[model samples]
Target: MTTTGTTSKQREQATRKTGSQSGQPIVAGVRSDLHTMLLPMFAEQNEIHDLETVIDGCRIRIRSHDAGVRIPTFMDQKIMMLLAAHIRDVIQSGGQPTRHINIDRREVIDLIGGGGSTGGSDYRRVTERLQRLHSTKITAETAISADVSRRRHFSWIDAFEEDILHTDKGKEVIGLKISLSVDAFRWITQGDGFDMTRERFKSITSAQSSCSRIYAICLANLIYAKGEDVYIQIEDLRLRVPSADTLKGFKKRPLSKAIELISASPDMSRYLSVSLVRKTEDGFIPLDGRAPLESVYIRVCKGPDALPSINKLLPLSETGGDTRSLSAAESLVELLTDRGSSAFTDTEMADMS
Candidate 1:
């Protein structure tokens, strides 16, 4: 299906660029600035799955569309990630944020580390991912304006067109043209949604751990704090990050290990400092110390100026308990999940001090 009501790809002179540069920025198509309004795309091992998560009264839902009764409906996170990388590049490259945009297939393959894979296989995978992105539906219901709750329903991309080359060996993908849906475009255009730094985002491209990338995305939308920190239940975090382990297995090592990796990463440390912790009857304890594992907390430190400013965002206090009405972590969630905008409600801001 073709897109309507907006501009598509304005053909540019195809510039030949080769190879991946380490630490170069990759723009993810579905970035909500640093706020995680959209659910994660996939876990480890390239699993195709469906998931739903709700914060406050808002729901971020993703599901696949399948006509065949025999085929299960799910969105592959790898496809979404690859497509996000391409879309990010296009927008950063000065292309218009219309539904339609063109990218070289080889560039996508290179971006996703498809080296050594056969051309036919690469082409097949890219085609399948595009189809999934086009077919999958995403629905988000949250406050888009003061006093009015809006429900946004749209696909990542409305429709796609590809350039194909047939040779004696097999069919090869030459290029792709895709259109961003109306709702998706609005989300990108609204507020400070696309305000992430390219350097911080590019760090994900070179990092060895996928969880580190997830940590960075989560950090982008976080409320800055000195000591008072943000927390997520281990199970809640497991759902947000893609992993190969079962929920039970993920808790044992992978989750903690991922947080440790982020702590040690220099590229990631530039933006924020993170540690895995658990809250106890006594108080919140760092997992690195001799704390018992119960509720897992991902503690995010104050990030760089590249992130949204404290003046415009909800304040997370450095101290907690009876001294403050709301803990920093609780306030952070309210900032993220309340009105689709990152700022707090008037009453909420009044309660902060």
Candidate 2:
């Protein structure tokens, strides 16, 4: 699927706007447990099977009909944001989920951060996406007690209707209403998920890969759910990426690459403090171990004040306006040293250097 330049820009702009709003309602909080909702970057072209992952502690597994696991693309994710934001708004207003949520076609476009009138190619695209979202299936389970547990199965939406109206401006699908599946409604209202802020959403949308987006979201979920800095094992991060189990799916090297991308991005680091460390049975292991890199760790930084020292280290590169061999290693060493035990050791530092 080759997305045209126009379509790609639209996606990026919509994502950027999500995090720009002020104190907005639920911009669509994906259920944290639905870890594999979005398909991986490399495998987006293929059909996904029974994708599964364990987010936090709950296990979430998804199986689609013959339609195959609909890997929620960037645009599809925006649709989710709209649904999530609407549900969040409804809940905050002390209103409950009705049988159907009616939205003006123009309103829908605005909600999704798109401009221009809602007609032509834009309307068709939005309509098709809503249908696709409705058809995707998922099953989520979490333990209730030592002997009790709960299971939920449903699609992202149950059904949708396009309300056509003939107005002076000509015929148009002025209104669009989507019926929420019971499970989707329940999860939106009662389940646990990250309350994505405009800034956080912007960061996630701006990320370059499936793993990078997953890493950022998981980190946000941890902070939101725990109300403090959280530590997630590297294995947990690896599992979050859909189709990442086999070598063809995803591997440790790609996982390392993903973590590295997050660490390198200034925008991502603003909302979440990310770092990669090695740990073994004996506790924190030296990076020099011939043992392959096991996992990456992530944490959400609490305040803007936490950034200055780390920011200062970037200037140490002294590249003299050259593009290649910018002494990234030297800067990394300084950055890690500043971060203390939370970053790599001398051996790891040399390896990176």
TM-score of every model versus the real structure: 0.61, 0.58
Off by over 4 Å in 2: 1-61, 66-75, 94-99, 104-119, 140-152, 165-171, 193-200, 209-212, 224-229, 245-254, 264-267, 285-290, 293-353
Winning model by TM-score? 1
Q: Model 2 residue 76 lDDT?
A: 62
Task: Name model 1 segments beyond 4 Å from true.
Answer: 1-32, 36-38, 41-49, 67-96, 114-118, 141-152, 168-170, 191-210, 223-229, 233-235, 242-248, 280-283, 287-295, 303-353
lDDT of each: 0.48, 0.47
lDDT of 1: 0.48
Residues 14-58 of candidate 2 have per-residue lDDT tens digits of 435433221233334322222223222122323554566655444
What's the number of clashes in each of the models? Answer: 8, 4
Clashes by residue pair, model 2:
19-198, 26-85, 28-84, 28-85
The TM-score between candidate 2 and the true structure equals 0.58
